[model samples]
Target chain A: MQTIDWIVLIGALLFIVIYGTWKTRNQNKSVKNYLKADDSNWFAIGLSVMATQASAITFLSTPGQAFHDGMSFVQFYFGQPIAIVIICLVFIPIYHRLNVYTAYEYLESRFDQKTRTLTACLFLIQRGLAAGITIFAPAIILSAVLGWPLVWLNIIIGVLVIIYTVSGGTKAVSVTQKQQMAVMMGGMAVAFTILIYALPKDINFSNAMSIAGAGGKLNVLDFSFDLENRYTFWSGIIGGTFLALSYFGTDQSQVQRYLSGKSLRESQLGLIMNGFLKVPMQFFILLVGVMVFVFYQFNASPLNFSPVATQAAYESEYADEYHKLEKELELNFEEKKLLAMEYGLASENERAGLKEQIVLADQKEGDLRNQGKEILKKANDKLEIKDRVEINDKDYVFIHFVLNHLPRGIIGLILAMALSAAMSSTASELNALSTTTTIDLYKRNVQDKSEDHYVKMSKWFTLLWGVMAILFASVADLFDNLIQLVNIIGSIFYGNVLGIFLLAFFVRFVRSNAVFIAALITQVVVIYGWWVDWMPYLWLNLFGAVLVIILASILQIFLSKDSN
Target chain B: MSPETNEKNGPKIELTWQKVFTWMLVANLIYVLIFYLIMKTFN
Candidate 1:
């Protein structure tokens, strides 16, 4: 990045932190104002909800996900609209009626304190770790591509979030997210524009999409019933719905966003807005990745995008093999580029013939890349650092494109976009984590505390969680895909949490003891299922939720019979 | 703040809950159709 780029990146981040803290100064006189924000309108609330979910992982990893995996990842959010509608109609009203500070507080009123505590602890554990990953996700990629130290990158993001979040509390998080979201969306729009404009002149939008489609990158929906297929339509709508329900409806970070609304209608409308905008936002980001994939068809792309991985291989005994693969990749690229150029001008039959060649060439390239990964793994072992570097290059695709292709000023803006996303999400997580800690645990257990005292405690907890997230990010390792890893972690716990809330809302007859016991059993089973790879992670949400409900009902009947 | 109204403190939309939900579902269906069309057209 140039000096101008650095200026833009640092300037944008500083503005968000300073603006947020300044705007929300003197606002946290009480616990409600500190943690609930207490005055957000529908629009602000809507953006805050959107920003919280679209973490740095969403920005940094998602396009890479789409570039490699195709647009099928979008199906993961297919259930969100339905989830939002349900939450608007069911969850919002209850949360508003009770005037609870945290989502878990309502659990105490409906079930026993144990059930509430159990659910809140589950959220804290998952979201707390997720907070670290959100920081680590962008930090790792930016560091890899920019040569920035990973630990410093993690600390920079964590501390940036902490400054504003700890200062202004929940209101600060909500307020600053509006600006961060603007930076994120605006930066992405600019990047997409540059990518499209930079595509070959003959390859208009339609032709570009055709090239992508021929390579099978445009497969947005899979209607297959296969559970093994990670993103089938059925899994998206069903499993995705359960995941969204738990996340938006039951998760404190999201619940707190809407709960800060000026009124129930405001919160409901804000969620409805998120529901409408989310899928398309994701679809557009994936489309950008598809465009990047198309750009690489005529241009050179690395056999492995990870610089660290590629370097390690070059420095090892497998260096000759790696050099041979590079030669093969160059030759392969020339042939594919020629065919792709011809494809833009081809007639129907010719297009079909060229499409086959293009697909075959793509497959050959993929095979070569996989071979490169195997060699890199072998080389890593020689270096005594086996498994330290991620073999998967999916997360590195977009940032590699940005650093190598984008203009200097724009590169900084994109970097700022990444930092903005990281800050927006990490702020919400720390804010919500602290809120749950303060309201559901500390304040609940230690009563008769002054309003100012609780507010102070909330800030301290926010700082503590902020530090914890930074420490976790420093030690974090690469998962299969950073975005999917975050979701998998959530799914492991969300199902049981959502099930508890579902039981509380609908199954009025089931007492607290029944749910408490069933939840424990269901949690163990869910973790075991995830451990054994019973199904895809998305389905874990359904499995855990259903298991909890069924077990709780049966246990309730058994308990009643024993009492009788 | 009964179930039907739930403390209606903002500007009222004329659409009922049933209608709003129908619209959201219909929008989803429309998006899915567009996705399928893209898949089919590209294939």
Candidate 2:
């Protein structure tokens, strides 16, 4: 990036941090202030909730996802609005009534202490690991593009987040998040507008979309009930809804957001706002990707988009073979582009005649690209199985375009947006993790401490989790679809967690032992079901909830009869 | 305030019809505009 862009990027980031710290400087000194912002209003809590969920993975990988996979991924959010309604009606009132710091606190009130501790431990494990992955995912990309060491990049991002988060706590997270969301959305909008203007003259927006549609990149909805297809409308609605419910309702990272509201109504409004906004925001991000896909059709894209892989291939023995294939692919793209343009301009009868020929040429080009991928894979296998492997799927395409094609200052802005997403998400996770650990585990089990002591311990826990996240980020591999990976990790535990909460809320007759044992069995069975591939990941949430309720009810009846 | 008084206040009702309707309208309008833009630009 140019000096001007670097200056702009650094200035924007520094301003956000300084602004957040300044705004929250006089925040009260108590556990309530640190964890829940002492019950703030709708706007602060609302924006923080949104920013926490919109991680670096969403900004970095989403556009690339759209570029490769098309817009069907938006289906994954179809169930979110419905899930929001459910939370508002059931989850919010109960949480407010209990006056708990974490969602698991309610589990303790309704069921046994064991159930509460188990649920909290599950959250810590899943969220703690996820915090690390969130930091690691973007750090890897920034390292690759800027040639910085991954370890240093991880520490830089993680430590910056830790400083503000440990100092200002929840108030800092909420305040900084408001600005982060604005910058993230504005940067993305600018990037999308620039991408459209950069397209070729003949390809106006509509025509470009038509080309994308013809190439099957505009398939946004699928009603198929297939278990294996990850993003079908059914999976999104059913599986996605359960996942969203568990996430927004039971997850402490989200619970803590609403808990900071001055009233229950404000928190409900904030969530309802999220429920309504999330789907469309995702749709727009994915649309930019579809446009990127069309842009690449007119331009000559690389056989592989990963620079590391591409560089390794170029330096290997297969360099000459790869070069020859690249030249042929370039010619093929030129011929296909001409055919597509002719087809676009043709009259009805003329179009009918040319359609088959155009499709045939397109198929041939696709096959040639596949052939080139195979060559790269083989060469990579020979060079070093671990280091030289090329696993380029669809998610790397947009980033590759941005780093190579966009102007200097815009590049820096995009990079800052990515870092902002990572830092915001990681900071929220660390904050939530610390709150759960201190309140659910330490305060409850250890010697009762004063408010000041608990507050100090919270900061120490935040620092510890932040360091742990940096360590995780430095070591993990590049996940192809990071958003999906994070959700999948959540699904494995969310079902059981949500199940425990369900039992606590509705099944009053069941004793603590029954519910606890039922949860353990449900978790094991759900893990087994997922391991054996009996159902897709989304169904696991539903399974976990239902299994715990049924098993707990039965166990309660049987155990009661035996005691009598 | 005592815990009983806090409970009697019943979580402080802020759910005004005007506010709810305003948010609903704003949210729907935003969705419509997004769809219009996508259809206009990409269709």
Top candidate when judged by DockQ against the true structure: 1
Looking at chain B only, the TM-scores across the models are: 0.62, 0.68
Instruction: Give me the candidate number with maximum TM-score.
Output: 1
Per-candidate DockQ values are 0.51, 0.16
| lDDT score of residue A538 within candidate 2 | 62
Fraction of native Cα contacts reproduced by each candidate = 0.53, 0.13
lDDT of each: 0.88, 0.79
Q: List residue ranges in candidate 1 displaced over 4 A.
A: A383-387, A477-489, A527-539, B1-11
DockQ of candidate 2 is: 0.16
Top candidate, metric lDDT: 1
Assess the local accuracy of residue A423 in candidate 2 as a C-alpha lDDT between 0 and 100: 82
Query: In model 2, which runs have C-alpha deviations exceeding 4 angstroms?
Result: A343-362, A383-385, A388-390, A478-489, A527-540, B1-43
